[model samples]
Every structure is written in C-alpha cells, then in structure tokens.
Target: MSKAAVETISGESLSRIVGAVVGLAGFATAVLAGMTTTNPGSVTLGRALICLVAGVLVGRLLGWGGEIAVKEYLERYRKDHPEPEPPAALVRLKQKRDRHEQIVEEMKKSA
Candidate 1:
C-alpha cells in the first residue's frame, strides 16, 4: 500500500481505539461514582458531565500522543536512511515561486 493510504488508515484506527478506550473508562468512572453517592439524580447528572469532560480530555491527549509517536517514528526512519540533499539553486527558486504565489493570493483576497 501507498504511504498516504497507510498513514490514513493508521490515523483512523488510532482514533477509533482511543475513542473506545476513553468511552469505556468514562462509563466505568460514572458508574462507580453513582454507586457511592447518596442522591441518585444529582450524582447521575454529575457523573454524566464528568464522563463527557473526561472523554474529550482523553481524546485530545490521545491525539497528541499519536502525533508524537509519528514524529518519533519518522525521525528514526530518517536516521536509518538519510536522504540526498536537494540543489540549493532549485530550493531557492521554489521558495521564490511560493512567495510570489502567496503575494498574488493576498492581492486577490483584498480586491
């Protein structure tokens, strides 16, 4: 499979797994909290809110963790197999073209 395809699949699978884990953990916490509380209604509402917040926070953490993992993996790969340096002239020309395009885009947007 292509690199792009592999990356996309890995990202989606990671997200799903993270989501499931967060959801399960949240549910378990809520249930435990509910069991320990005296007021059923208040406890249930509070537990639900806690679960929602926990799931969001956990998901965000997982996303950052995945990004870090990918960065580390790429760094290791680069270390193992170094790439040849591109011509300096060609790199400068590409940068100039990019800058020109950006200016043109800004002009068009302001028009």
Candidate 2:
C-alpha cells in the first residue's frame, strides 16, 4: 500500500481486521456458553458458527463507520491546527540569501 493509504488506515483493511477479531470473540463466547450446558454438541457448533458470521458482518459495518468518523475527525483536527509556515530550514535559507545579497551590494559600493 502507498504511504498515504497506510497512514490513513483504509476502510477495507480496518473492516477485515475488526471483523476477524469480533468473529473470533463471538466464537469463543459461544463455545464457552455451550460448555456450561449438559449437551455441548452440534447445536453448540451451529450456534458458534452463526455467532461468528453475524459478528463478522456487524463488526465490518462498525469498522467502516469508525474509519469514516476517524478520517473526518482527523481532517477537522488538521484544519484547526495547521502546520507552521516557512519551515525552519526554509527560513534559514532565506536568511542566508539575504546575507549574500547584502555582501554583494556592499562589495559593489566599495568598488
């Protein structure tokens, strides 16, 4: 991925990651819940599979929304706190240019 894409956290990657995490959590939860019951068989497995699928779908949606919200918040934050103008290096270069001009003018006057 490009630098900008990596830095901004694309919705696709975020959604997938969130979906996988939520699906795993749901699966684990379902399995644990089933363990408490007297019959931990096909029904438990079915429930776990359903939970995993549902969690992934829901989590993906949530993650996409979260990515958009974060992007918007970052945009607003960047707008509010703008970068400084004439960076330090540029300011130094301008100062050096002014000094060189002054020296050349002084040399011309002396000649």
Candidate 3:
C-alpha cells in the first residue's frame, strides 16, 4: 500500500490503541511499585494521574512503533515476493510497440 494507506493501518484501530494503553499502564504501575517511596497498598490521585498520562504517551508510541515495524517487515516480504505483472492492456500495448519497431526496422532495411 501507499504511505497514506499505511498511515490508516497505524492509528485507526481502537482495539490496538486500547490494548497498548492498558499494557503500558500495567508495566508502568509495576515499575512504580518498585521505585516509589510511597507506602504499599496506596496511591495518590496525582500520582495515579501522572501514571495515566505517561501510559497514554508511551502506549501511543508503542502502538505506532509496532505498526511501523509490521509494515516495514511486510514491505520487505513484498519486495522478496514481487508483484504480479502489469495489466493485460499494458501487455498488449508493449507487444504492439515491439511489432511497430520491428516493422520500422524492416522498412529501413528495404530503403
């Protein structure tokens, strides 16, 4: 697909976006649990909000990164596999051009 179409694949999936955000939140919360000086079994609203915002930023980054990686991989695969030939009309046109070139060469030879 073209660049614009590929962009749609990255940002258009609600499920993927939500999944990334939730996954980031879980990971960040775990890290916070270990790194924070706060007491166990308690979280302040401000801290919680900070985590939420951080998760969202990281999640968006993760989601976009994943999509770009997949797209690049698929593009590499496509380069290996190669696309189908051009359409039938184009094939016919090329054949006609070749025949015309042959006829022109014959005329030049006779001349």
Provide the TM-score for each candidate, comma-separated: 0.45, 0.66, 0.45
Best by the lDDT measure = 2
Model 1 off-target regions past 4 Å?
Answer: 1-13, 78-111
Clashing pairs in model 3, backbone N/Cα/C closer than 3 A: none
In the range 2-101, model 2's lDDT, one tens digit per residue, is 2232132454467678878998899999988997897658989999999999999998887777767767777888889998788899999999999999
- lDDT over C-alpha atoms for residue 10 of model 1: 50
Q: Rank the candidates by TM-score, best first.
A: 2, 1, 3
Error of 1 at 107 (Å): 62
Q: What is the C-alpha RMSD of each candidate to the true structure, in Å?
A: 10.4, 8.7, 11.4
Give the per-residue Cα lDDT of candidate 1 at 111.
Answer: 100
How much lDDT does each candidate structure score? 0.72, 0.81, 0.68
Best by TM-score: 2
Residue 37, model 2: lDDT of: 92
Which residue pairs clash within candidate 2?
none
lDDT, candidate 1, equals 0.72
Candidate order by lDDT, decreasing, is 2, 1, 3
